[model samples]
Target: MALRSNPTLRQRRLGAELRRMREQAGLGGSQLARALGINPAHVTQMESGKTGISVERLRTIAALCMCVNEPLIEALAEIITDRDKGGWWEEYRGRLAQHFLEMAEIEYGAHGLSTYTMAFIPGLLQTTAYASAVFARGFPRLPPHEVDLRTAFRMKRQHVVRSGKTPYSAYIHEAALRMQFSGPKVQAEQLGSLIEDSERPSISIRVVLFNVDTLPVNHENFTYLEGPIPELDTAQMDSGLDSMLYDAPAHTAQFRSLLKRIDSAALSEEESREFIQSIKKDMERNYG
Candidate 1:
């Protein structure tokens, strides 16, 4: 099979697991390929997530790895054989960055999400005006039409918040709230929207204050997504140029620990509401 140029995060995760299994079995790609009757390059491709594996081949590989758990093998086989191509982002396939598209797919599939943002409000919670302003600042030379289209795409993704079925929790630093992305008026509106969202049962918003002196210095924006299955839990870290998706146990454990620390340092639900309201009032007093 021709190598897939754009592999999904799920595919990459499965490939990582397969590579770990092979290493644990003390087998090299060439030796494993010989046993499986496939080319070593193909084995490398599958393990690196550049190519997909067939269900039968996946089972055979699992057996060779001494993975006796039928359910685990079946789960791996299912991800390998998955043919679902439906996603809301298909229309913007060539327009947006690959990292944004991947994030959209994973966010849509997640059962729950936890996010920590220190610089700006998370995209899912951003108002259209605020988002547009931020995007415009980043893409200063882009044509007006292109800017509007990108802004609309971002606004459309906000529907994930109101879907009601899935839950999303965000721990935002006080610095993000203080930043005036679109001047005082837009900032006030954004803060009001956050307060409104906090009232929703499925959405939790907390502020991490600078005065609190939190131990973990969260400088990057990161999100932890809980999938329907335990094995599929994933984390995405924003790195400006390109985002990174991690699903290993070690990465997941680190995120879980950070989540605990953030939750502890953040203001309580009631306190968050009051804090946001106070900021909004102050902004109005100074700007209005």
Candidate 2:
């Protein structure tokens, strides 16, 4: 079969895990190639995500590599099937950066998610108007068509928090609530929408008041996407005009720790709701 021209993140991840397992077992590509009865180049191709490997072959590879993480192996098998499924995000392939589609796929498979934002409401919780305002303020200033497309794409990403079972916690700074992105009317709607989304059983909204001192990971906005297995988890953050996904153990651990500390600095759920209510009332008094 012709190799994939552009492999998805999950595909690449599966290959990476296999490569790690092989190295841990002290097995070279030639040794594995001879074991699998394929050329050494073929093993290299699989490790690079240039070609798909059958589940049976993957299991054989694991056995040869002496890998014993059953759960992780199962997750890798599931990722194999996932690559075959052309998700809804496929429709926007060439229109937006590949990062957007990869993000959607990552969130779709996430068992849980935690987001931290200093300058804007979390994307998954944003209402259409709020998203439009946020996108409008981007550098180079997007045209109306692109803004609408981004808004639609963002709204679709909310499905994981809405209909799916992925539990999500968003730690938002108070400044974002007062930014007044579009105007009073739009801001009011956004505050109202935030209140509504916070009520969802799967969604947790926590506010890190401006007064909160020394918040964690204060440098930028990011989302921590949790996988079924710890080894498979990833952390995503914006890098320039694109998104960067981090799956290295150290990076993932740092992100997880950052979240724990951020949660420590944030208001409790009930307190956050009350805090948002006050913000909304303030908005109504000033904007309405």
Candidate 3:
């Protein structure tokens, strides 16, 4: 099989997990290659996600590693067998950045989602008009047509949350509510949309008030995507034009702790709704 020149995030993650299992089992690359009757370079390629692994090979590797964690093995199997081909994001492959497609793939497969935003509304909750306005602010100034295309892609991405099958929790800082990225009208409409979305059974919206005793120092915008098992969970962080996904156990655990702190400081669902309404009314009263 031809080696993959550009493996997706999921593929790379599977390779990392396999390497971890081997390390835990106290085996070297050459030893594993010898046991599997393959060249040592093949092991290197598999561990780096440059080559694919069959279910049989994966199971054999698990046995060689003496890994008895059934749940984790199943999770790895799922990644190996995933045939989504980037899911709905495939259509935008050449049109949008590869990062967007990878992010969508992970989002679609998440069992649950938790997000915290300090400067803007969560992408899944932003209305079309609001999304357009947000996109218009892109650096280097995108042409009008490009902005429309990007906004449309973002709106479509929201379907994962709108499907109402995946549980989602969005924690937005109070300051984000007041930022008129577009204008008063768009901002008010976006807040109103958020109010309606909060009513959805599968969606939870919380507001982190400015008056909280202490806020986390790490305010980077991030979304924690829960995998089928805790071991596969991922934390996606976005900064400017870069998007980073961290699935290492330690990193994911730290992100989980950060989310817990944000949740504790945020208002309850009912209170968040009222708070949003108040902000919307303020926007209208001041700029109507």
- Which candidate ranks first by lDDT, i.e. highest? 3
* Cα distance off (Å), candidate 2, residue 204: 0.7
lDDT of 1 at 150: 75
After superposition, which runs of candidate 2 have C-alpha atoms over 4 Å from their true positions?
Answer: none
Best to worst by TM-score, what's the order?
Answer: 3, 2, 1
In model 2, the clashing pairs are none
lDDT of 1 by residue, 100-157 (tens): 7788878887889999998899889999999888777773466777778878888877
Candidate 2 versus the native: TM-score? 0.95
Residue 162 alpha-carbon offset, candidate 1, angstroms: 2.1
Off by over 4 Å in 1: 68-74, 139-141
lDDT (Cα) of model 1: 0.84
Query: Of the candidates numbered 1 and 3, which has the greater TM-score value?
Result: 3
User: Residue 189 in candidate 1 has what lDDT?
Assistant: 96
Any idea what lDDT model 2 has? 0.88
Q: Could you list the CA RMSD of all candidates, in the order they appear?
A: 2.2, 1.5, 1.2
TM-score of each: 0.90, 0.95, 0.97
lDDT of 3 by residue, 1-288 (tens): 899998887888899999999999999999999999999999999999999999889999999999999999989998888833557788887898889888888898899999998889999899999889888987889999988998898898899999897899999998899988888989999999999999999999999998986876475589999999999999999978789889889999999999888888899999999999999998888777
Give every collision pair in model 3: none
Q: What local distance difference test score does each model get? A: 0.84, 0.88, 0.90
